[model samples]
Target: MVSLQIVKQSNAGIASLPHGLVVLFIGATSGIGQSALQSFARHAPSPRIYTVARPSTFASHESLLASLRQSNPTATYKLVEADVSLVSEVDKAVNRIIEEETKIDILFMSAGFMALEGRKDTSEGLDPSMSTRYYSRLRAVQLLLPLLNKAPSPRIVSVLAGGLEGPLNEQDLDLRDPNNWSSWNSSVQATTMATLMLEKIARENPRLSIVHWYPGPVDTPGLAKIQKFGMSFPNPMSQEEAGERAVFFTTSDRYAVQEGLLPVPAGLEVAKKSGGGIFLLNPQGESTDNEAVLDEMRRRGVDEVVWNFSQKVFTACNVQARESKDEL
Candidate 1:
């Protein structure tokens, strides 16, 4: 049996943030991303936070901002209105930040979705979920590399399953085969890419700390969607098969599902309270690196390959990565 380490809240592994930390959060609208946002503001020394999201969706998030302001009245919040899942939009957003700010200490890339269908390619002709989950997030890192390097104790955290990586369909990197592609398949692919790329980027930019987190099952709104749409992969137990599946998460069955709406405090609290390692924040506070896989990524030129391909993806999309225009 694999020994699973469980960290309790009382563990001494949590670390506090420094003052005047300039952090950028993508996918801060909901789920684990939102959790981290709320938690960071609550714990970090007053920070200048810029979150990238769509303008149409901004009004819906006012209540969240209100609560966050309540927790940390001094928190400086800026909503960079854009669709970060697109390379063009990501480039524009980062450019805007660079134009304004001198440096950004932290870049949190957690924008992704658990799509329940086969590949839905974007206008850029890239797989939508994959683009959002891996490509778009990677683009943010590439564009912000210079700014991240300029900061002290620079860190890039991508919240996805790194340790739980599975087989990569190298032959079909895009996973376009309708027969083979599924949401779970896409997730597995995204997870694989994130694991390989994080190690790759960490190696190339040795000065910057790269962390890809696997926040173990927290009952967030996303979980409800996963339950609703049914997993892309083989789900062993549907609610029909087992009441536990339906019974456990069935409390919110009353609300209308209009294809939108979405956190909880756990993720933010975890991000606020983490310290060492390329942190994969478990339910509790501690983190541990998967040395075996990381070592392999180093041995293989996977990082370079991934980065090259990623840049090619952005290049093919004709996205211009411009710095932000805001004053520091």
Candidate 2:
């Protein structure tokens, strides 16, 4: 476990790194994403930060950004309005970023939730929870690959279940059948599919350091919601600590594919990558080996299956959005 002290000490070095580091954050309105964004904005030197938020959360997020700017006057924050649960919306958000930035050094994604209320499909025929967790997140990465590749050392940090991959319902990757669908199953499918897809992306873009982190249980608004369902974890990590660790994962060389960001902290070695390449990290910043399930999936070419399926979903979403627009 990388101690909290080490995480904070590493993060303090961010100010020394090159200034104006361009970062794009998806789902930074609340919880871990919000905390991580605050941490990054506080330390990074003259950072250029872009965050996405749905209409409902824009005002509040703006207020958050206002305080961040006050804390670090050198940083610039732009909040793009878009509901990330929709792939089309994600494209629109990314396009906005692409229009202004030449390259993105870091793409931090933590926009997701547990569908404790059950499946509620969006207009594009996707469960909002699954879409936010897997489909939209992957779509954003696919669209931003060109920009990411241009960076000296690009990194993608996905805050979700990385080490906790489980059996996937391959027959129903989307879990369309009601009988096969449940909150638990949906979460599993999202987590498993995310790992597979990220592995594929990592292999294709070897320079990009992708960290899929399972931050265990964090005490946040999301966790509070879960508690309402009579489920709670004992001694959940504080959001501030989680945020510091997240920044460590984002900037510390310990998780990097190449040396560019903050150097690995003393007494620590570079974290190990999965069989297919990206870092599957546990909360303590240690690499996890879930090859018992991942290796077989890779051997069976399940990653490709996931990649292809994801593309079709993106295509379908675009078509649906276009048709809907034409109707008006």
Top candidate when judged by TM-score against the true structure: 2
- Give the alpha carbon lDDT tens digit for every residue of 90-145 in model 2: 99989989999999999999999999998989999999999999999999999999
Mind giving the per-residue lDDT tens digits that candidate 1 earns over 97-140?
99988888778776777777556677677777888889888878
Question: Which stretch of 10 consecutive residues in model 2 shows the poorest summed lDDT?
Answer: 302-311
lDDT of 1 at 87: 78
lDDT: which candidate is best? Answer: 2
> What lDDT does each candidate get?
0.61, 0.94
Q: RMSD to the native, candidate 1?
A: 10.6
